[model samples]
Target: MYFLVMKMRSSRNILPLLSTMIQRTCKFSALPELTKDRYPNVKRGNYSQIDTKHLNFFKDLLGETRVITDENECLGYNTDWIKANRGYSRCVLKPKSTDEVAAILKFCNENLLAVCPQGGNTGLVGGSVPVFDEIVLSTSLMNRIISLDETSGVLTCEAGCILENLEKYLDEHRLIMPLDLGAKGSCQIGGNVSTNAGGLRLLRYGNLQGTVLGLEAVTANGQILDCMSTLKKDNTGFHLKHLFIGSEGSLGLVTKVSIQCPPKPKAVNLAFLGLESFDKILMVFKRCKHELGEILSSCEAIDADSLAATTDNLNLKSPLEKFPFYMVIETHGSDNGHDEEKLNRFLSSLMEDGTVEDGIATNEPSKMNAVWQLRERITEGLIHDGYVFKYDLSLPLENFYSLVGIMKERVGKDAVRVSGYGHVGDGNVHLNVAVKEFSADVLNKIEPFIYEYTSKLRGSISAEHGIGFRKTKYMHYSKSKEAIDLMKSIKKMMDPKGILNPYKVLPQ
Candidate 1:
């Protein structure tokens, strides 16, 4: 038996791609038409004034091949790693050079169209995602190492350069990027510079504020701030590039970075030590600083829970016979034997004085990575347990444990489980809470209390993660009212339209 199909035309006089009744009988029919009005439309946006002609103008400015409008190809650019924030842009623009970026920005500015600049999209915050369906300007194509000067220890690269590649490039030349992160493989240098990322090495190499000599960014007005210089000392009128660092792309789009690299150390040593109390952490740091001096490259802490989670997750042996508040200390030196001798002396003295509990030392590459994995993979295990409320905080190192104790008391046991770890030397502690669920009401009640306590202690709400959309509202507790107002005024002056990463660093 055969069925006769009847087609119906809608208000637009377009034939129904699939008849509701006919679609059921036949296995296949015509493909569903893309409902541009329903699916592709930007729900909340101020760029309605922008016309297709303007888009075409920019498309023509950049070659037609570089403009991507297909839905499949645009999916990757629309969302970031976490999948929390996302929007479907009309098109994705991939520019290969700074000139292309400038031209596109100029066209967007003239058309009054908002632009969303994207890097590796590995950001935990929603800064890289488009809240509105503005044109996504991707730096992925702009990745190119322009120069690397061994003598000056400076590496200049386009914003889209991958952090891991940069590290590899520097390694081949016996140099290193001053910053290193767990997400180094995926995060871009542009995002790093834009967020002013502080990572594990910050304790030794310092933050980007010191390592980044200069930066070049494209402002909302289509002007590029070309501050890419390797000058160690420049008494300029103002250190303008510093403003864009950690701005989360609110003021401008960073295009190129000229970062100061450090010479690679000849030797490195790793030690995993157990401690009974959090209070002993400060004492341990002091002793290490005094005894190890500049060789103390890293000082990180991990709680008992973190150790168990990491060991279980990675299927590795526990570094110690018993799990206690753990600290991983790393030392680097020009001479391997000298560094080892210093580390041995320090450990021996600590053991004799009962400052350090049980300890394990490793110079073996595999063993070193094993211990580092235990420290790095602690957060990854939280997902298996339950929902997580991750907090990257900076407080007095002494208050770390007591703060967790208070939180556990407030949130209640089993309902909330807290694990502690992070760069202890820098005072940035990763206080993660595991819960069954997190609702707006609970977050509303809990966040205020946490921020108030942190503020009372004269600590920052966010240490490494910048004030992106997630934590913008809590900025008041972290910064003074006057400081926030000045930041707003600066934002207004720099980006009059507030199109550059709107609703990101500033509270809505």
Candidate 2:
């Protein structure tokens, strides 16, 4: 009986071992092999590699426990959020304070070592991860809320604080951060400020450039430039904080941020409308603006392809019959009764005029959230559909949905799905093309042509997502030579060694 029991226990252990082996093999095999060689223009810099002395210096600066040298632990930092970009960094340095960040940059600069400053590592572009063996200076441990003023609604916090945590903290005080995104749970405020992330709330609160009152950043030479102000109005010289707002960490590393937070609305209402065409979507947006007015916090649009993908992947049925286009309009106000009255009135007018095929409006928290899930879950669903080539652009309102059709015709059979959805309130459309896998031929058909189409319309190639390495070569599509030259000059002046986020934001 004892022998039999031993045999069973051994069998159980062996089964798990076999399972683990199979998982590890599959995981490793699934990992895409993209190295610096793929980007032939980005040659390794002259910066020295990590050595024992360098490791000891970091260990001494930020205790041994904070320096992660294990290859497995560093893997998470080396890979981007989309798993499209991978790096080969050997170590990740987690610093707890602004002083630690300053000291690390100083040491790396003096040692001629390349460094990549990382926040929550939630960036969609390849900006957060390193291309080669650059040491990762992570701000994950520097998360601390410095202060919150109940009177002025100004909240100051460290750079690494998660967006959702900040929102929760503000909820207790009846305030709301001016930004909201799908990745709020994992994306850090520093990265948001770095990328100038414009999410669902931008249509209501404006961009971060206006909401961010002040910032504190560390230069490549280790100088701590502190402009941390909490005042709503400041006529400071040059407004240096604006430089780092959307710089994408190419010039300096943002260590602290002071932003203007608005009061949390007491009542929130959402209307999910199914329309027959993009023309109706635009008409609804204008009517909502005129009717809902100040209470209209968000006006987002989704095409049939996007809705179909969301329904297929999430298994969530649309509240109304599927149409060629869908619009999710949200209203926020101090009184639920007034907000709902306005939303209902607008919906009634739309339905009576035959502008909307079907629609649903709800103020109950559960039902309202169910409506939002359809729009917010589109990004997650796209990942499962296949590899997504996402393009966020600002175009003339009339020319917004045209590009999606143009691209569909261009790619034809190569693309599995071509969908369009975005913040229609602000004229930003997220054009996503899903394919079974990445293909150079597909990319060639989409590029220069799309940029040309947007440029001719006098629209921006990148609306919210910054010009990371992926879009560096296309800067000319949106900016003039003189503008790009000034950017290059500023980069050279700030980081002479080009050690901070090398081969990014600017073309080679």
lDDT scores of the candidates, listed in order: 0.76, 0.84
* Candidate 2 lDDT by residue in tens digits, 1-508: 0000011111122111011111111112244456476566678878898899999999999899999999999999998766667889999999999999899998888888888889888777688889888899998888999999999999999999999999999999999999998888998999999999999979899999999999999999898999998888889678899899999889899999999999999988887777779999999998888888999899999998897766776666666654678898888899987777777778887877788766677777777777677888787777766677889899988888999999999999999899999999999999998877767799889988888999999999899988777788888989999999999999989999887988778887
Worst 10 residues of 1 by lDDT: 1-10
Instruction: Summarize candidate 1's per-residue lDDT along 15-60 as a digit string, tens digits.
Output: 2112122111111122222212222332454665446786687677
Please report how far candidate 1 places residue 444 from its true position, in Å.
2.8
Please list the Cα RMSD from the true structure of every candidate, rounded to 1 decimal place: 15.3, 10.6
Candidate 1 stretches with Cα past 4 Å from truth are: 1-45, 49-55, 63-65, 70-73, 88-90, 314-317, 413-416, 436-438
